[model samples]
Every structure is written in C-alpha cells, then in structure tokens.
Target chain A: MTQSAGLVAEAILPTFTEAVELHKSMVFSIAWHFLRDRSRAEELSQDVFLELHRRWGSLRSAEHLVFWLRKVTGNRAIDMIRSRKVRPETSLDAAAEPTTLEQMHDSLLASYLERMVATLPEKQRLAIVMRYQEDLEPDEIARILGMNVSTVKTNIARALSLLQAKTVGRLQPNTARRLNEMPGETGK
Target chain B: MTPFEQELKRALARQQPSADFTERLFARIEEEQAAAPVRWWQRIAQWPAQTIWALAPVCVLILLTSGTMLYTQHRRAVQGEHAKQQLLLALRITSNKLQATQRQVNEVESERQPNQKDNIRRLL
Candidate 1:
C-alpha cells in the first residue's frame, strides 16, 4: 500500500507539470490582458492553477480541462475588475480619433487595438477577448460565462462594432473599410 | 478576419508567466502543505461517508464516557462540599457543648470552695 501510494504521488508531479506547461500561457494571457498588470496577472494565474490542481480529479478530459481553465480565468478576471470598480473612461461613443495612418503600422496597430479592447466594459472586454484571443465560439463563451448564447452574441457584436468605430479613420482606407465590413457590423 | 481583429489577436497573444512562476507555485504548495499538515481528526473527517458512519458509535461512546466522567466529578465535588458543611456544623456544635460544660464546671467548683471555707470556720 505504501509503495503504491508513493508511486502515485511521484506520478502526479510530472503530470501536473505537463498540464501547467500546456495551459500556463493561456491562463496568464487571459489574466494579463484583462488586468493589464503583469504581476497581478501572474498572481491570478498561479491561483487558477492551484485551484486546478485541487480540483484536478474532477476534470475528465483535455477538452474539459481547457474549458475549465478558460472559465475560471475569465471569471476571476471579471471579478477582479468588479472588485476594483474601474470605470473605464473610453466608451464606444467617447473613443478618441484613431491614430494617424502613418502611425498605424503592424505593431502600433496591434498595440492600439489592444488598448481599445481594454477600454470596453468588463463583460464586453471578456467577450471580445474570448472571441478573438481564445478563438472560442459564442456558444462556447456563453457556456464559460454562464450567459445566454444570445447575450454572448450581443456582447461580441457590440464590442466588435465599438472596435470598428474606434479604429475607423486611423488605418488606411482599405483597412478601415475591411474593419467596417467585419462580421458583427450587420447586426448593428 | 478583419485587420482590426487580427491586430487585436496579435496584440493579445498568449504571454508566458514569470520565469520562476512554476517554482514559486511549487514552493507555495509546499509551504501550504507544511503549514497545514492534516491532523488525525481532520484525516478522519476526510474519510469516506461509510467509514464515518461506522465510527459514529465509537464517537458516541467516547462522548458518553467523557460526559459521565465530568458528571461524576461534578457530583463528587458537590458531595465533598456537603461533607465539609456537615463537618463544620459538627465542629460548631462540639465547641458550643465544650463551652457549656466549662461554665457548669466553674459554677460547681465555686459552690464547693465556699462550703469548704464554711467547714474550716466551724472547725476553728
């Protein structure tokens, strides 16, 4: 009995190590993007993994594990935002004019969009992050967020429209036109 | 597929945790484990429900035993206090009796001494 117990204990470390290696980036990225603070994000990521370790026995498969991590990370991020009561200043209508076309190069554009996404409401920010960053479907996001599919769809659509509005005149004409023609534009 | 989203995705790409993140987590786990080593009772609490059920009678027995011991100890204390009260009452009664006997003896001795004096006077 002792030998078997020792073996099981030894086996758990490697298994947990691999799991952490596989999912740490996703966990850390979700927290980082949501909180925009590297240290806090790392702390939250560690907490999520610790919780995952505690509840590891309940997770049935790799897919379920990924889903669980995403759900927990997103929920924790939203909780942090709510607790902080950070009223984002940048609203859809209040968004400043986009950066000049010359300044909207690849890296700059990426950073600009990131900043814009960060300025959304907590739910919309999480929705957009999950939709684009995690590449999750609306239904999957709904499942993770414990919201209706329609609500998730609405959030994603509104967020995309807002992003489009924010970036409209900043990029080249072709890029701005493409942004306007994004998937969520018709629903508005 | 919009350029804006593509940019957003690139901007928000998966970031790695701190270089020592895993090590710190492990240390935390170990520290937590060390801080709260499971006690015997806690281990019992974590046992399966059936095992806990099986131990219910033993728990009841232990509770009853301890309760009986405490009750006996309380009863003994009460009994001892009653005995102490009885002893104090007996001592008070004995003291009163001794005082009464001494007064009687003093009265008798006084009476005898006066008779002896009268007898000596008659002899003289």
Candidate 2:
C-alpha cells in the first residue's frame, strides 16, 4: 500500500507542477491586467492556482484545463473588481527617455493604448484582453466568459471604438491623425 | 488588426508569475496538509489540503452526532440494567413473602389434625 501510494504521489506531483509551470503566465497576466495591482494580482493568481489544485481531478484534458483556467481567472478578476470597487488607474503620461529613438515612439503608443484598454468597462476590458492579449477567438472568449459569441464580438468591437475615440479625442490633431492611420483604427 | 490593437497586444502580452510562485504555492500546500485532520479516506484519495479545511465543519458535525448517539445508547443500557435489577429484587421479595405464607398454612393444618383426632377418640 505504501509503495503504491508513493508511486501515485510521484506521478501526480510532477503532473501538477508541470501544469502550474505551463499556465502560470496566463493566470498571472489575466489577474495583473484586470487588477493592475502587482501584489493583488500575484495574490489572486496564487489563489486561482490553489483552487485549480483542489479541482484538478475534475479536469479531463489539457484543453479543458486551459479553458478552466481562463474561465476561473477571468471570473475571479471580475469578482475582485466588483468586490473592491477598484477605480481604473489612468495616469499614463510618464514616459521614460528611451535609450534608442526608434523604440521610443512605439513604446509610448503601446503604453498609451494599454492605459486606454485598462480604463474600459470591466466586461469590455476583459473581452479585449482575452481577444488581443490572450489571442483567443471570439468563440473561445464567449465560452470562457459564459456569454454569447456575438456578444463577445460586440464587446470587442465596442471596446475598440471606445478606445479609438478616447485616444484620438485626447491627442493633438496631427498625432490623432497619425494614430487613426494605425492599422487598429481600420477595424480589421 | 489595427496598429493600435497590435500595439495593445504587444504591450499587454502574458506576464509570468514571480520566480518563486510555484515554490510558495507548494509550501502553502504542505502547511495545509500538515494542519488538516488525518483520515484514511482522505489519505487514500489524496485529497487536496484545502478540501480538508472545507470539510472540517462536516467532520465536526458527524463526530457530534455519533457521540450523542453513543451516549444515548449507553444511557439506555444503564437504565435497562437498573430496571432489570429492580425487577429481580421485587421478584425475590415476592418469593420470600409467598414462602412465609406457605409455612403459616402448614402450621395451621398440623394444629387442626391433632384436634380432630382427639375429638374422634372421645366420641367412640
């Protein structure tokens, strides 16, 4: 009995460890992007993994595990937002002097866009993150979020529009025109 | 994809957890395992440590219910023994009284027999 128990433990421990190693980034990033607080995000990520451990036996396949992680992380993030009433942080003005001139412009634009996405409504922000950051399909996002696929697509579209308006509305005309010329503005 | 969306994706790429995250999680799991009550079924199933904590109240409830039942059975057994002893004592007392009444009847019958024999001799 002891030997068999030891064997089972050996098999399970490595599998669980591998799973955690594989999916930690997805779990952590979802929390970080949603909460925007490094410590809280880390804590939330830990809690999610612990939950995953508890429910590990119920997960049947690798794909199911990934889906479960996304759904749980997304739901937990939204719950955290609701419970904490966290106001979105909007201060994106601080840009460090870039070592290289070429990378500076792109980094600034990226940071600005990230802030805009962060400030969106919770569902829209979550959808956008899942769509772009996670690069998940609308159907996958809908499954994770328990929403209609059409609703998920609609949320992403609305989020893009809102971001475009916010970005272009705030920048100087020349800069706005430049941003509008960017590929995301074309609604691809 | 729009340049803005592309940039957003680049900026919001998946971030890794801290270097010691797995280690810390394992440590917490170990601590929980150590704290949880040991049970044969749990050991057999290798239940996650959090599950033991979650089921603590149920365990307590089961223990309480079983304890109460055992105590009730014990009290009933004691009461039954007491009643048995009381019935035996009552039966012994009744037996003694019946034996004393039988001895008094024997004495009366012996006294009547001697008197009847004397009266018959005198009449003859």
Candidate 3:
C-alpha cells in the first residue's frame, strides 16, 4: 500500500525502487533528447537517479520528487555540455540546413528535431527540452532553471524561431509566412 | 498550438530508454552508495523518513534518561567527597581535644609527686 501511489494525504511515500521504475522514461528521454547520444543519455540519466537516491532523505512528496528529477537532470546535462564543451555530432553550423521536414518521414522529422534541439545553446536547449519533452509551463521551466519566467519565454521563443527558420525554408511560401505571422509565444 | 509547435512537442515526447534502464539505475545507485565514504550518522539519516520519525521520540527519551542518570551519579560522587571531608575534620578536632585532656592529667600527677616529696621530708 505504501509503495503504491500515495492516495491518502498521510500515506507513506513510494519506495526508491518504485520511484526509479515510475520515472525512468521521463528522465531517460530528457537526457536522450538533450544530449542526442544513446550511451551518454543512459549514463547521464542513471547519474540523475543515483543522485536522487542519495538525496532521498530530503524528498518531501511525489511532486517534489518530480521537480528534483527534472531540475537535476536539466542542470547536469547542461553542465556536462558546458564542462566538456560538446558540440553536436552533426554540425548545424556547417551542414546544410534541414529544409525538407515536410516530406521527411515522421521518425526522421522527430530525429531531426531532436538533433536540432541538442545543438541549441545550453540554456535554450534545456528550456526547449523541459518545455516540450516534459510539457512544462514556462513558469515551471523558469523555476526549474532558476531563471525569470520572461527569460524562459524568451529562450523558448528564440529556440523555436531558429528551428522554424531552418526547417521552414523548404515549406510552401504561404505556409511558412502563416507560421511566421502567428505570434510564436504559444508557450506563454 | 501551431503545427510547427505541435511537431516539436511530438518529436520530443518522452520515450523509454533501453529496456534495462531501471535495473541499470538501481545497480548504479548501489555502486554509488558503496563507493561513498562511510559516515555512521549518515547511515541513520539515509533511513526512510517514517523510520526516523518513529524512532525520534524514543531516541530523545533514551538520551534524556541517560543524561539525567549521569548527572545524578556525578552529584552523588561530589556529595560523598564532601561528607568524607566533614568526617575527617570532625575526627581531627576530637583527637586534638583528647590530647589536650591527657596533657592536663599528666601535669597534675607531676605536681602531686613534688608535694608528696615535701610532706615526707617534714615527717622524717
């Protein structure tokens, strides 16, 4: 009863194993998309959970647990990128801009988007991953990133515009114009 | 949501890592715990929060009772030393008074001896 989700207000918290089982996908996916390397993603995500295990004493509730998981994973991934100065495997700078997202298979498009997101500035990349991958609101992203809500919004908008510009280059002129004309702050 | 935004969200949707992610994670946690430097109190801290809560009052009670026992024992030892000192002072005073009384008795006997010698000479 205790290891299961705590239905009652005073219920015992979930065990560490249960927490690991429940949140592995979310944690792994964030690292996977952020780092764009399967092996490194596995390592980074595992490190995050390991950290959670060590700090399990201070965890207050399930919600707090999720917050910690996201915050730690995001910060660690960014720190890893900065400390190592890891550039994208494929050069977004030198490679041909991806102008054919329309005809690309869904899986291909997804992979492309993942790669592009991984190449963004560390802060912008984290903001985008947390924003889209976790489906978090900007305020939540700001809290996780320790940034102002406005700064988070700006990062997301700027990242979105960059991806849009690169991906939208091959779109029908009208469709591209419509996407551009639409206010991009959908996240706000 | 714009189509572009929708695509972005869809692309970034959470996916499971390799099948053994949990097993690997648990193993890694174990490895980390083993590798970390040992601190005896930190072991207690790592216990489940409920366990900590359940044991807290009992721990406090134990500490309080032990502390009080130690304090009482120390006070008794100090009092015992004080009583021993008082007894020693009393004994010393009694011995001094006895010595003074003995000396007075010896002086009276010596005075009587000299008087007796004067009386005997007059009789002769």
Candidate 4:
C-alpha cells in the first residue's frame, strides 16, 4: 500500500462512518418496511452503507448522499425481492381471518397493512413504502424509481385503494352493518 | 387526513433498526477496510489473485483445443504415411512378380531353342 492512498482512505473513513451513522435509520427503515424482516433489512442496509463508502467521492452533498442511499437501497431491495421471488405469505384475498376490525389492535392492523403492502405488485409496494415510510413526494419517488411522476402517483393511489377496500369491505358482517348505520361510512 | 390513510402512514412509518445496528455496521466496515487493498500497488498485486479462478477455465480450454488440433494433424499424417507405404509395397510386389514371370519365359524360350538346334543338327 502506498502512503498517499492509505492516507486518503484514512481521511475518508471518518466521513463514511459519519454518513452511515446519520443515515442508518433511513436506509435500515427502507429495507425493513419493504422486506418486513429485521435481519434481512439489517444485512441489506449494511451493504448499502458499504456501497456508499465505496462511492463516496461521487456524492456531492449531504442531500446527494441521502439521495444516493435511497436510490441504491430501494433498487437493491427491489432486486432482492425479484431475485428471491419473495412475496407476502398471504394475499389479502387468500388470508384466513379470525380477527375482526374491533378485535385487531392498532399495531396489529398496521402489521396487517404492512403484510398487505408486501403482497402488492413490486412497483405499487415500493411506491407505498416510499410515500408512507420516507414521506417522499411522488415526483421524488419517480426520480428515484426512474418512473414517470404520474406512474408513481398511480401506483400509490392504487395501493391505497386496495388497502382501503380490503380493510373496509371485508369487515365482519355485524360490524359492517353497525359501522355503516352509525356513520357516513366513507371508509376512507 | 382520512383515518385509513393515516393508519397506512402509521403502519409504514420508518423505525430505527435494532440498537446494535450501527455497531455491527461499523464493525463490518472496519473489517472490510482492513481486508481491502489500501493502495494502487496493493490493488495491482491482488488483481491476478482475485481473477485467477476466472482465468483458469479459459487457459484450460485453450490447451485442450490446441492439443486436439495437434493430435488430429499428427494422426492424419500418420494415416497418409501408412497408406503410402502400403501402396509402395504393392507396387514393388507387382514389379517383382512381373520380373519373375519374364525370367521364367526367357528360360523356357532358351530351353526350346536348344531343343530346336539339336533337332536341326540331327536333320543335317
């Protein structure tokens, strides 16, 4: 190892470490929300950080670094899912339901929705995850995903509509009647 | 702000990875950095070592192809030589048989000539 290159790597090491420390939440959360598996998410986020460290020179600013992290992490997650052909354990249509809306706690409902999101087509699932998890705009997601803004919006909208329909329309028989009778029942 | 969309947002909100996530990441980073080539010379030195596996099959393929080609040419040459030797032997055998037949014919003619001479001498 030459002295100058060793010095360069040593100098850049702290910056890379700082980047990982600062953005680990965002990067880790993206994988977790997408894959819904903690170990896999952790493994994937480490890989992303390693990649970020490798490409540190190309990144221009803090924002660009974040952008790079998001783009790479999202793409990697999508690629992993595609390669594994991994899907949610059950489709909303096929899952056997023993719990009613009233019986499902808030976290349980959230879990259900998260699983349902996993069942969504890849684009729609990613769109939903980025929008809700990262709070990214449709255009921002479009830029990250290399899709038209309208396409991103369509994916999010369709995913939301599917979630709402599956959650609301499939309520218990008496629960649906009671909820329908008592309220405007927009179910939005 | 609808209840369901809000619920969706709540469902999808980002959560930090496990508490040791950063620690594990840094540990791995440090391990990789330690293992990685730190300089241009180091990279050059490691290059062949890394790619030796990939290059091995190509080298084997080249050797196999060249060996087959050389063997095929040598076999063809050997076959041609064998055919030529067989042809020469047959020609030699044919010449020898023709010469032997000619010698026999000459001897028979000589023997007949002597008999004719004797008969003529007797007649004289």
* Candidate with best DockQ: 3
Interface RMSD of 2: 6.2
- The order by descending DockQ is 3, 2, 1, 4
Error of 1 at B14 (Å): 1.5
CAPRI tier for the interface of model 4: incorrect
lDDT of 2: 0.75
In candidate 1, the residue pairs with backbone N, CA or C atoms under 3 Å apart (3 or more residues apart, or in different chains) clash, namely none
| Residue A152 C-alpha lDDT in model 3 | 91
Local accuracy by lDDT, each model: 0.76, 0.75, 0.80, 0.74
Model 4, residue B15: C-alpha shift (Å): 1.1
The residue-by-residue lDDT of candidate 2 on A48-139, one tens digit each, is: 88887766656555666777888999999998889988767763233332344233366676766776677778899899888877777888
User: In model 4, what are the clashing residue pairs, if there are any?
Assistant: none
Q: Every model's DockQ, to 2 decimals?
A: 0.21, 0.24, 0.33, 0.18
Tell me which of candidates 1 and 3 scores higher on lDDT.
3
Candidate 4 lDDT (Cα, 0 to 1):
0.74
**What DockQ does candidate 4 score?**
0.18
TM-score of predicted model 1? Answer: 0.64
Error of 2 at A179 (Å): 3.9
Local error of candidate 2 at residue B22 (angstroms)? 1.6
lDDT per residue for candidate 3 within A1-188, as digits (tens), equals 31122232244457888788777888888888888888888999988987887788878778778788889988888887778876787655654655565556657766777878887888998998888877778998999999999999899889998888776675566656655665465673
TM-score of predicted model 4? 0.62
- In model 2, residue pairs whose N, Cα or C atoms come closer than 3 Å (at least 3 residues apart or on different chains), thus clashing, are A183-B2, A183-B3, A184-B2, A184-B3
